[model samples]
Target: MTLSRLACLLLAAAPLALSAPARAQAQGQPQGQASPAPGRTLRVAPHADLRTLDPVFASIVITRMHGLMIYETLFAWDSKLRPHPQMVESFSTSEDGLTWSFRLREGLRFHDGQPVTARDVIASLKRWMGRDTVGGKLAEYTAALEASDDRGFSLKLKRPTGMVPFALGSAVGQIPAIMRESDAATDPMKPVTDTIGSGPFRFNRAEWRSGARVVYDRNADYRPRAEPADGLAGGRVVKLDRVEWVIMPDPATAAAALQTGEIDIWEQPGQDLIPVIGRSREVRVERYSSLPNQAMLRPNHLYPPFNDPRARLALAYATDQADFLAAGFGDERWWKRCGSYFVCGGPNGTEAGAAGYAKPDLDTARRLLAESGYKGETLVLTSSYDIAHIGRMAEVAGEALRKIGMNVDVQFADWGTVTTRQANRGPVDQGGWNLFVTTASGATMQSPITNIGTNMACARAWAGWPCDEEAERLRNAVAEARDEAGRMAATEALHRRLAEMQPYRVLGQYDQPYARRANISGVLEAPVMVFWNIEKR
Candidate 1:
């Protein structure tokens, strides 16, 4: 069935009046605001349903976007990728650089009308450190973290490094979101249901539906910085009174809604549908970032076959990046075949040790599979059917692996279910997965230290537990390098080591353009979609 025909059928079957937005509005609005003005409400059709509210518990983009609406960080990356203070009023370091003192900005209040104190920040950082890759590295150097007073805190480091502020302000996976002390005290592994923050928007928990819609209202009490708005930094001035995220998993339905002006913005329009959608004068397709989003095929290191380095290497040798990129993104103009794990066009982009596996070698793959002692065990490849590109990537990879003479089982489900199953560390027969497809922002993939795929913290690492002491050593060397020259050299060495370790395979890099109504303005060019500063006409 053609996508355009599928879109027409879906739209005809479920009319817009009885769609998710209508059902969502019937539920309820925020406490004080009985009804929002027409232009004050910005309706957005997000790529996926926001099932998980806690960004720390899940590293997915939907949860991260949800968190950004309600939460504020101490520091954030600017347009130039430089760290700038957001919540911190003042900070200082001792001569030895071991003792760091920070004071919270005054008048910072949570949605529940409570003051944001240093104790809350301390607790939030502690909880985040347990799960986030960058936070874990920061935890390694921390000697003690304590609240000096109600609005002040101090971090004492065992040994000084330059990753303190960067770790706190990282806009990558599992951002260190500041929450109330009570809420931050929740177990790191568990989800925090309470949504109280000092950011520009407040999460409307009463109006939130699992698969239908998620809503946020302007935080009337939020204080903007003196500086003008920048990328994920500067003043977060909320222009719209309310932002509604209507969950539309089907691309055709979303495109139809977007064309009809039912939704103000479509976060991710399918690449194949861009040409059709772009023809409308009312809609405009805009590229959010210059850096492309990189696709990855991650294998489980805890299970057999992939547990062996040779088996992992075999998969890398057998598969071609062009196949994944072409299957995932149809337009050649939008996608690039890149071998660099750090992103091809970025500053640290290098294909140092990827030459041997640059193109597919079936003979080498077969030899490696035999040497790894694989007994044709069924390898379960889990993926989400809700996401079109990722689903296509999974199918392409599964077929490629089967051609290399391995028993492969492809499983498809909703994104939320796939993520839940991905968390299971048990065997494949026991609801565990051997492989999964995911993506990371190019902004996060530029540095070896910030990229979660390069993390080798064993049990503490990201989903697939890959442990290598030498890789960790080389990564630290890159982080601790004195100069840019030294850093690049260390990065190349680490890249070489990563190629041998085979933690994850980088499929390719591609641009993800956002489709928005022509009247909507002030959409900031950021790594992720943010609600603040966007105004609907």
Candidate 2:
């Protein structure tokens, strides 16, 4: 299917036209609770908070999972990261490949029972256009957004955005379809009392049980697969009336709850409990593949002594991938050798430059560091210790750098703090930091519009010097590729370029290894991260 390629726009068109003021509003109206509850509810606890609910914002896995329930994008990706049409019934680009039109789906109504109009798209994009708006990042790519008809909208591009639809598939695409003028008055991201969305499920009351548990009742509007999914279809709507997501922060406690029936599902199942869950009589164990890298993010590789390609190569050579992988995850192989910035490596994963990839060349490393004109700058490496072994990764990488006449200053921080700091134009005083590992869910691997920019292009923008002009050009190309063939070729080219330059060393890919009891049925899994699709036992 031909997808609509929309870019991030920076200009504001109109507000969401919201109703409520900027004050702290109640979460949502508590209504139609099942038997206690009516709709199916599931429990989930990942390593971190999901990304923002506004699809246009940064594609955080957690946010996507939550937004998955309340929002709909123009294009959607299936389990295999394949783009699938959702909100838009049909869409096509113009002959010149600049303007695009979308035919909206009919009979679609937001949870508030309001008819979704084309203007909604414009307003959503407008709110997202401003700095830090939902799809704020889109401002960099898009020129303007204009609604054409009641049922469709038209997006004009200042530059050719051949990859707009895939972008629309992202979080920004899931913006509020029907916002009141008042809702748009203030920040659109704050929870709205009137949660309006046109999705399979509707928003319900959420109860935060003081870090111990959070329960959410479902809306009856939730429509299930009436037909079969090749075969595993035909379940009566859903089995459970309400899926109470007990946010057990402790993994072991989460497993224990699942075992004791305090909780029905263990979203963040620990490895220690994996064996027990597999053999449990009351629960069921299901397995799935994950993205190749456990820790896949770009580190600022442009600092002086290390800025030299040889120094960067030396760091890569010194890194022990096998030992690092073993320490991070005992048996997680979701990540293979990925030379490119894109995670969830495609068939083109092993293309040209990535063939003979992983080799721990200590001797070569030493030689390269010396050649890089080592003026002796302490390599200040920072990373997220939130993930199991990411801090350990910094240590390992630091040791490798130290071996080659490089003094490494390893500093670790919480994922959110580091991410927030970087998003707000990185640390200034520290000479932009020699090396740092940022936490990116989609970076690890995401579906549909998995361009190299959100994963790597932004890496350039975030690095000490944004990785230079040449790197930006290559990254933009990867983001702007029109078709699969063009995308594949460009991605391969990028992989080769980064590998040659050693922009950031590939630490590990994502293997979303979670624990679930024997009872939970109809749970869908995404390799890298994000777990919104699940059913209760």
Candidate 3:
């Protein structure tokens, strides 16, 4: 699992370099699909394989996009960033604001041909609330979740919580996707076999070949709302009859395929290859997401040396955000130095807590490490080199840490294996990991209320599991604030506490550009990539 061994493995696993003619012939087009059918079938090369099928288990970008395609939510955020009714026909709260009632639109049917019901909605929300960091917090304020009728449900809260609708409609990772009661009853930690959803598209499970390809067919029975498509809200019209997600690990091959018109869209193209794509007359390179991705370095709180706050602070000081930004995004134009726990330029984004860890302070870092304890233990730096940015960031971090006289062990693997390994909480010598690098969409870090990385509740927090009582209290304060200003003030305080805790380090922000052929149209500019309104001309 060392870096050199990992490189050898990658070379062995990658598709061999082939001649242009051979490469073209290898992409066996679907039978009778030689001619472009415009809205019939759209071929795409996603950034990575769809590893986790259950949206509730993993919050990665690809999984979220898959969730958006196959499942429907009661509410959705509009272009104005306001919560709007999607599946919900109407909703209201009692005068006390403690009781909220909701009714779903009529004729909603699952991919399995079963009618959607309120009992399903109640069970689905209950299961989602138990897994999502924000939903778990919101659940603390709820007294009960009950179904009022076949098409309606009611939520009775212990106090006035205005975030109920927003929580259900959150655009962040792991959305509360509506599902049948039978499917929703699966254990939160386990994956469900049922892919049945009532969304605009249905998952073509028969064609899903784990690391190779995945397919989705249009749900003709779906009835879109009257409103026009806007963001993830409004009408979700499935213009393409079939959406094929072909996994190509090699960026050059993906770019070449896009150039040859074998692929309609490349969800994530390496920055260095943008020019190559632009040179192709038929291909167009553009920034696909509304929010820049937030890169992060997470340390395991269960094991040493990061278990100690001073040790975590030392590592944070030794690392430089600019180095990671430059390594991941070569050009200064695509990336920016961000010094905030929350996303910069957003409503709750602030630098209130980013004081000393903005730049590299190797001297201070060494001194702090010495002060914590002189014992030299190897710090495991787990990295997923499959992702170009993540791998570059890890190399930069490893170099920085070595300079500060720390023993470092750099282990490299694919992103899927890295994410799965991060959950192990044992000692590093056994099966646990000390540190890892990853990125989150800005949508996930906008506020303490929706941020999963900031969750500090003991045993119930996300992967890294850094528990800080002060940070937890401040997060609750942010959630309970009555006005926008109050919420902002509380958020700033929470950010300051997080800065002190050093649970995780925010490296920087970079745009992930997507490349597509000119014939494709109606690609929505959203935080999560969507395929509903897109067409192949």
The digit string of per-residue lDDT tens for model 3 on 380-407 reads: 8899766787898999888988898888
Q: Per-residue lDDT of 267-292 in model 1, one digit per residue for the tens? A: 99999888877988999999877788
Q: Write the number of the candidate with greater TM-score, choosing between 1 and 2.
A: 1
Per residue, candidate 2 scores C-alpha lDDT tens digits across 292-367 of 4335435454446655777766767777666665555555543344444555354445334543446777788778
What ranking emerges by TM-score with the best candidate at the front? 1, 3, 2
lDDT of model 1 at position 68: 89
Clashes of each: 0, 57, 0
TM-score of each: 0.96, 0.73, 0.93
Query: Would you list the C-alpha lDDT of every candidate in the order shown?
Result: 0.87, 0.51, 0.82
RMSD of 1: 2.3
**Alpha carbon lDDT at 501, candidate 3:** 83
Worst 10 residues of 2 by lDDT: 5-14
Residue 290 of model 1: what lDDT? 72
Model 1 Cα shift for residue 226 (angstroms):
1.6
- After aligning candidate 1 to the native by TM-score, how far in Å is the CA of 253 from where it should be? 0.8
The number of clashing residue pairs in model 2 is 57
C-alpha lDDT of candidate 3 relative to the true structure: 0.82
